[model samples]
Target: MQLLIVTAHPETQSFNFAMRERAATVAARVGAGLSFSDLYQQGFAPTPGRADFQDFPATQSFDLAQAQKAHQQHGGFALDIQAEQEKLEQADAVILQFPLWWGGYPAVLKGWIERVLSYGFAYGRDKTLPAKKVLLAVTTGGIADEQDAQRSQARLQAMADDVFGYMGWRILGLHLVHGPADLDAEQRAEALNSYAERLRLWLSEAVPLAA
Candidate 1:
């Protein structure tokens, strides 16, 4: 299996990064080809602009769809965006690892989605990306409670129904690791281990797309 892990955390030693490392290790153990994009470490640009396209006219009003389509047709996307597109195309599964900030994706990650998953590559009238399994590994500092769990579930559902599902991707799992801020060292280790095992199990199984 080919797996692509995209991590958007800034601190390499944080729990989010630890989860990413564990994912890499598990991918190696399962003999899955692994590719990664460390958004913060790579200094990924989060804002989309004219710089993303080549030969885009200076006078015309910026139209994302038009720019993306023109750039894709003429091989005009920035190198970084092109590289990410290639990785996404080659992967059978994708894992998004990050700490949930304000109940949503980090700015850089959101930017990555906007720029790399462009018109004609990710979605368009005649072009939609092939279905692939996707997993969201979200970390939260707050303790898991009934209310928080409900909110998280709602958010995940929205993402599934509105984002990934709309884009023709299958949602395999939404793993949330909560209360890392209050856990002791042993508890934290156990939490990480349990999540890692869950991820391994999910990756080992064949999950059909939801109808």
Candidate 2:
């Protein structure tokens, strides 16, 4: 099996970094090959421009044929879009790992998605990519206890559904291990163990992790 991991942490020392490490380690142990895209370290640009939409064939609407023609034009937009598409094609599973910032994904990661998951690709709906293979491996500094409160749980679940589920990816699960700012040794171990176990379970089961 092959897994694609896209990480959006700006710092190498962050818990988001550790989550990628743990995920890669577990996947390797299970005989899964890995490919990673580190957005911040690679300095991926998120801002979209006319060039991103350039060579976009004149069409009545955003349709598959227009997108295909645009993709055929080899240039800045096509190159970057092809790179992401290649990664997605090469992997059996895709994992997005990022720290939850301001109750959502980092802007860089969001930009990567916007740039890469173009029309006629990830979700043209009619031309959508196969959804079951994609999953998420998210890390957050917020404590799990905080997520357990009724309002917080509802909000987070909605976030997950809208981001992953709505986008057609089956959310494998979230690694919302908490307190990076104040983690004790025990807490750290507990978090690692939980992450590893969940990783194993996801690999073992063929079913989607979302409800």
Candidate 3:
């Protein structure tokens, strides 16, 4: 199975990076092929423009294929939507890992979803991907209790339903680890163990790779 992990954190040694590493490592151990795109590290450009709405060889009626072609033909990532769609197609499971900033995902990650989950690609009348398949988010927030359903989970899940599920990608999971950086040594170890366990369960149930 192919699992794509998307991380949007600036610090290489941050807890977000560690969670990403742990996720990739366990997924690999469980026999799934692991691939990742570190947005900040890759220098992903998070901007939308007019060319993103172009219609030359094809009409501008929500054609992801055309948008992708236009992006490559024009330049690198004229829109974040096209870039992420390419990644979304290549993976059986997608993990969006980022720190919750200001009650939501970092601006870059949000921009990625806003621009990449386009009309025809992520959602439209005849979109091809399966429902809840993409596995919308893997995120961390400093505040623990506040990340609950009453606080932000419902809103976030609704957004996921609208964006990824609407696009026909089953949300295989939504793992939110708390206090990634604020944890002490013991807490860090416990956090890692918890994350590893959850990830292991996910792979065992969903991924079909050789042991």
Candidate 4:
């Protein structure tokens, strides 16, 4: 099985990165072919624009869908975006690991999605990429209370239904690790261990997507 882990944490020692490392270990244990994209380390561009295309005319108004379709047909995607698309095409499962920045994905990851998953690629095509499993492994500082937790859950569910679901990917799981900033060392370690076990179980099982 091919597995791709895309991590969008700037700090190497951050809790999110630790979780990503745990995921890497689990992928290795499962004997899956693995690939990784450390966006921060690679200095990935978070803004999508004309640079993404090589064949589009400079004077043409940037219509994202039109430009993407044209560029894809002509092999005009920038090197980075093309490489990422290639990786996605080969993956059976994709793990997105990032810290919740201001209640959403980090900008780098958001950009990666916007740029790499282009029209005629991840969507707008007859096939809509390929059927695969997606796991969102997110780390958050803390949720203030039950209301905050509910809000977060709603937002994540919307993403699962609207964003990934619309693109034809299956939502395998949404794993949220909370209180990473406030937790003590032992508590944090325990949380990581628990998450790792959950990941292991998920990897070992063949659970179907929810309707």
Alpha carbon lDDT of each predicted model: 0.84, 0.69, 0.68, 0.84
TM-score, candidate 3, is: 0.78
- Cand. 4 TM to true fold: 0.93
**Model 2 lowest lDDT segment of ten:** 67-76
Off by over 4 Å in 3: 51-83, 128-132, 136-141, 144-150, 208-210
Q: How many clashes in each candidate? A: 0, 0, 12, 0
Q: Please give, for residues 1-70, the per-residue lDDT of candidate 4 as tens digits.
A: 7889999999999898899989888777877778999999999998999999866688878888788887
TM per candidate: 0.92, 0.80, 0.78, 0.93
Tell me the tens digit of each residue's lDDT in model 3 across 70-140.
Answer: 54445454444455666677777887888777777788887677666655455666554434355544454
Model 2, range 1-211, lDDT digits (tens) per residue? 8789999989988777887898888888777888999989988887654445546655446554454535644433556656777888777787788776777778998887777766556666454456646556565555546445444445556776875677677766655555565888788777877888888788766534333
RMSD of 2: 4.9
What range of 10 consecutive residues in model 1 has the weakest lDDT sum? 202-211
The global Cα lDDT (0 to 1) of model 4 is: 0.84
